[model samples]
Target: MKTITKIFTMAAAVALFATTSLNAQTMMETDPNPAPKGMGFKVGVGINGGVFRDKSPMDYAYGADLKLQWDLTPYVAVTASGGYTKLIAKDNAVDADFIPAKGGVKVFPIKRMYLATEAGAGIAIQDGAKTNFIYSGGLGYEFGGFDAGVRYEGYVNDSASTTYFRKTGQYAVRLAYNFKL
Candidate 1:
């Protein structure tokens, strides 16, 4: 949809601007503690956009989420997030919209780089729509206070008969701003 495209474009611009501006500042100053103090909590808000897999009636997907993360160690963390997503339908098809709540783990193999996995339920928002099981995995990098990740997400429907597609997936990019809590 046009709205989704516009939002995605705007988010990309903002991210680029922030990254360029902050990179210069960070290079000029080195913090003694680049990582957070031991075992802390962080909160983040993000927006995502992606295209649906082939043969799907949906044209694109877009969403926003709020996440809470607890750092278990410098190399590990646990996260919980909830979000609203909309899969824009192709012509003559109905849209799919849901709210997803997920919990997962993040492992930092190297400084500021991480791998993540998550699974949860996606609750349908439309009347008579069925719930779905959702899962995702991704890799990302953190710089300054921004986290950018690319992920593949899938949705599975339990019932055989449904108004929406039974199995669908997308590849998405998420850009978030995080802060310690």
Candidate 2:
């Protein structure tokens, strides 16, 4: 699982650097209008489905997140998100649910394209409402009012339901609509 996390982290870093270099080259050749520095707000909701890395084949997971973004610069923003996740045990129909809240930075390496990473915490309602640390990283594109992306997320806990780092984490494809407010 650590190996998988390292691989994903490296991949994300490489993609970010490559995109940043390309954006720099493009900027040198073309003068694009600057994005407003004034504060801005955007709200979005997205859904994702994935498997727990440590869980057996029978465990299926899905979740939804609501996000609030504050654009501080053309290439930078701050984001806060919270959501609910459900893990279903296919064998016995047992279910575990969680609520996660996290905050992170969003960086746009190119127009309408972004890389974001965040960390915070989560609460598992089962097993006596245990709390765990949470984190995620993702890449996404925003076109007009629509956004789509993929992210890897994990909770750092070793519970009877989710055996801590054993499952590694989750990889999910996400889609959302961001409304500028």
Candidate 3:
């Protein structure tokens, strides 16, 4: 039964990955990147990364997410994002994979330039301590149905830290598809 389940899980993962890649390609091929609908809500997927310091060594982490956002003003927007992540080092001692309940505020005060901040709470993979207050901010450009973004995310343990170097922070460059609903 375990073997069957493992195979099933692997097959499912492959299927989903293929689908997303194909969808992205199709959109790129057919769409000339027109401006998305304005004054409405948008939702899409994104990827992220971060690193943490533990007793043993440092762990490098990567994550993927789906986000739903609402335009609160021409210069402000709010987003709900959740997704999977993994942290790796010598061995998988901590929960590298997690689906964090997170939110962000975005502002485009200047043309073609956006600034945003985000925070969240989540359960990590395995038995690692539950993470609290995931936060990030970045700059981005909105181009038609596609956006290019650069952001940084920080992961903090439930216990407070006295120094900045003790926290886990990941910097990322992301390209995302935008849609209206």
Candidate 4:
């Protein structure tokens, strides 16, 4: 499973690079506007909520994130984000909390619509808990400085027997308002 995840991540990176290069070349050749659209830095604040998988002890997860984005072209952007999330406990289970830091690429295939993939570490807030690997993929629409996306995110543990960091997944929705920087 790890191998597959690695392969997928690499493939996505390569695809993003290729697309960005192509788009840059095309824009350089024909774009008339001196000040291009979607060519700047942006900062955003977002909140998310979701349900964990049925087998998990957590009932729901909710969080907020701060994001920085740099538009490479009208079609591609790079992003870095960090956020706090809480895994609300089910009956008799302990709640878990984490801070996740990630970097990713967003590719716009059509106007106002984008696909994104991100990977990073989820640092556990509980003492003695191990950090987990996190990955997510999602699609969203951007309009009037607001972006809304839904994704499937996973936290993968290296050691399944550990108290925390067990493999878990969730489906989450994020809504953010961006400010130009």
Q: All candidates: CA RMSD in angstroms?
A: 21.6, 20.9, 23.5, 21.4
Tell me the tens digit of each residue's lDDT in model 2 across 61-133. Answer: 7889999999997778999999998766555754667788899998988777889999997777765546678
Of models 1 and 2, which has the larger lDDT? 1
lDDT of 4: 0.85
TM-score of 3: 0.65
Give the Å error, residue 162, model 4: 6.4
Number of clashing residue pairs, candidate 1: 0
Position 10, candidate 3: lDDT: 100
The candidate maximizing lDDT is 1
lDDT of 4 by residue, 1-181 (tens): 9999999999999998888845334444654322237579999999999998888767899999999989988888999999999878777676778899999999888777889999999888877677888999999988888989999998886574243646788999999999888
lDDT of 1 by residue, 1-181 (tens): 9999999999999998888855334446643334565698989999999998778767899999999999987778999999899988788687888999999999888778899999998989887888889999999998988999999999887664254675888899999999988
lDDT of 3 by residue, 66-98 (tens): 888797766677889888766565453433456
In order, the Cα lDDT scores of the candidates are 0.87, 0.76, 0.68, 0.85
Query: How well does model 2 score by local distance difference test?
Result: 0.76
Off by over 4 Å in 2: 1-36, 54-58, 89-94, 158-167
RMSD of 3: 23.5
TM-score top scorer = 1
